[model samples]
Target: MKKRLSAAISSVGLILGTSLFSPAGAQEIDLYVDTVTKQVYTEPGKNRVKMGTFQQVQKGANRQDKKSSDRQAQKKTDQPAQKDSVQQARKDSSQQAQNEPGPAFVHEPLPERPKEEHWYDRMHIRGYTQFRNSTTVSGDKDAVVYWPDRSVGEDTSFLIRRARLILYGDITDNLYLYFQPDFASTPSGSTTGNFGQLRDAYADISFDDKKEFRVRLGQSKIPFSFENMQSSQNRLALDRADGINTCCRDERDIGAFFYWVPAEIRERFRELVANNLKGSGDYGVFAFGVYNGQGANRVELNNDMHMVARVTYPYQFSNGQIFEAGVEALHGRFVTSNGPVNGITPVMVAPAKGFVDERVAVHAVLYPQPFGLQAEWNWGRGPQLNGVQRLITESPLTGGYVQATYKYDSGPWGILFPFVKWQYYEGGQKFERNAPKNLVNDWELGVEWQVTKAIELTAVYHMMNRTDVLNAPYERFRADAVRFQVQWNY
Candidate 1:
């Protein structure tokens, strides 16, 4: 009987434990044991039904409650450890950021860079102007002595000799460009009336590290005469001698020229150029070129091209004086007007063959150190019309000029230079209409006072004896003049 009782109690405890610990549901039944009937019962939806008998239903319920309490305490202990681990992870992240090299927070992106400018945008500009006045001092009213191109017709006149604007700059590391225009150019069919004309438009292509060797293309000054190559704004004399002027009218042409100078002497070349002596940039000891023989502003008359070359060396003494020597040559064709085949018959003929013109020249200069000297001579052959018959015939001619000058650098008065020149020329000017024969003896004395860096004043006296082969009635004439000029440069 005791065994039966114990079995029933144990069964009831198991059923109760399963009902309380198992997952609960909405329609679950509540199992119960009736001690009076010693039987189990179930209460489902408020109806109690007998299930089984049990002696310790209360003890089983108490044991279940103890287990639930222990489970809740364990959950509470594990939650704090989970929270500490999460906090430690956050702290580790902060420490890592502090140990880093750069900023803790990323910076806003940098603004995009501005666009770069083109090479042409960096161009440089410079220019100068000469205002001149001249009067015949001891000559006929019609006697145009110096600068026949700018003669004083009424014994005195004011003239804008030269007004120029220069534009130059580097196009690239190995390329450079230069351009100049003259507003004072004479009116001609090739140009607009005195508005302006292109003087120099050229590009320099450098091959060496220091640009000691270069090739120049376009219309630029030919490398023939030192005086011819020298900038008119820098010349000490009022005008270039007829001897050298006849070599190259305007001293510029459409051509390609090669220039070379040693790197060691480049600084010296720059110095001379800066001082406005006869230095041709860094155009070294050797220069040569080929051009249209008709000269600047003139179209080529014949198919033949003119060839020019020069060889020069500039030496500097310990005393800071400079001496330069050079030789130059040019070979070209000169076109002339055609004449009647039968002189008295009044029958016309084809134009005479183009004159084969050629010349060779030598020049030397001693840069002024308070006192200096310069000299140049040239000889050439070209078609010359006879004084009376006016027929083209080849003739040999020679001419040159000698100049002496003294420079004084006065403190407030600026640089003062007094100079004297003697020039003589007997030549055939092929570029002229009839190829006139020119016999000229001229003397000039001048003083240049630089009032400031941008201003200059000059006064000059001249004496001359000239023979014009083209003018029939007045082939020979003697003339003299006094001239004054003011120049502004920037």
Candidate 2:
């Protein structure tokens, strides 16, 4: 009896041990992360492994024997069903857990919200002031001389040509003004005078405090040419863009322009400058209603209201580059019939001569990382000369320029952008003869130092490289001009 009792106890112990160590007691599972597709795994020491619904657990229940062999056989027959049942139980538990929240702190509290930038307290008082020395190879040669003096070197000399002062303040939240005055006109040509001209007197209004959509009015840049309209204060080179905007000595115009930008689009922008999207120039109607048709340099006004407009489209590529393009057009009225005499003698002939002024332009560029290229062309009717009448009529003059820029965003000296530009221009009736049938070219090379967020400085050297016969007389083929400027923003 004692032996039978001991045998029973041993059998029970064996059965319990088998169940405790069975595959049912423990199972292995695999998991993977969604995006990285990396194997989802848990540290051996982690409290609990975070596993998703994906699971495969095959387990079996222990076989308990009865007194009869048939009963033992029956239990063996139930092994498959029992294994299925165990796995099903695990699946059910996983589903229930999915429906319910996980145990405490499944995800950590995001690093405390970064302190929001205080925009209201931010009143950015930023602008630039620069002193420039200019030496014209020959702006005054014809002014004081009856006949050209080959030995006088009268056409080549340097003087303090421009003294610029710019002030822009965030007066209150919605209202702002940019008043930049240029003290220039140390005339070296025929006359010498010191005069001050208003470069920018614009009031900026925005829909929101952040200035997403803005409106600017007053004497600002005309949205005509990139080189023409780029703020002289921010230019990386010297002299001008070599286009009509600079070559014509017409930089700013008194007008108004509205800016429209999409929120997503703004994010993609490189944001080199806070107001990079703000076009100092844009296309709109009644562009001539408020100001003279000629650029800022011309004091005369035309008869008809001038109109200008621009449209730009941007595209994004998978290779992580963004490109954009735009088109612009303007029309105005100017005295086409002129000369020392009069008659319809437009040299660079256009459709409407001696009456209305019309200009059309288009520009496009593809901006890749660290590199950008821009090009533009402008054709219009302006003062013309009569080959027939020895008079100035509405003549057509065209100006265009191309430029390339390369930048290294990360350097010991902060972001550095060096660029090269070339331009072809013809405007005055006499100058049109010099224009090549196809094109002419002016060149420039320079580097910009973005030194700091509040301060920017640049120096550039400029030259005109064209055949003496094809390039404009003012567009003398040989020249070397250096320009330097700095800006401070509070």
Tell me, by TM-score, which candidate is best. Answer: 1
- Tell me the tens digit of each residue's lDDT in model 2 across 119-182: 4444443444444433334333333211111111234433344466667667767887677776
- Candidate 1 lDDT over 1-490, as tens digits, reads 4544554465455444444433222123344433333333333211224553322233366675766666466655644653453344334433432343343233457999998989878689999999888877666657453335364446456788889999999888789999999998875324233568888999999996788889999999989877887788888887888888887768889999998888768788788868745354665589988988777878777887888889999898888889999999999777755343224211111134377778999999898866889999999887676656446677788999999988788899798889999999997766665566788898899999989979999998887788654343326677777788899999
- Position 175, candidate 1: lDDT: 90
Single out the weakest 10-residue window by summed lDDT for candidate 1.
341-350
Show pairs that collide, candidate 1.
39-52, 39-53, 40-50, 40-51, 40-52, 40-53, 41-50, 41-51, 261-284
lDDT computed for candidate 1: 0.72
Per candidate, the number of residue pairs that clash is 9, 14
lDDT of 2 at 332: 63
Q: Cα lDDT of model 2 overall?
A: 0.50
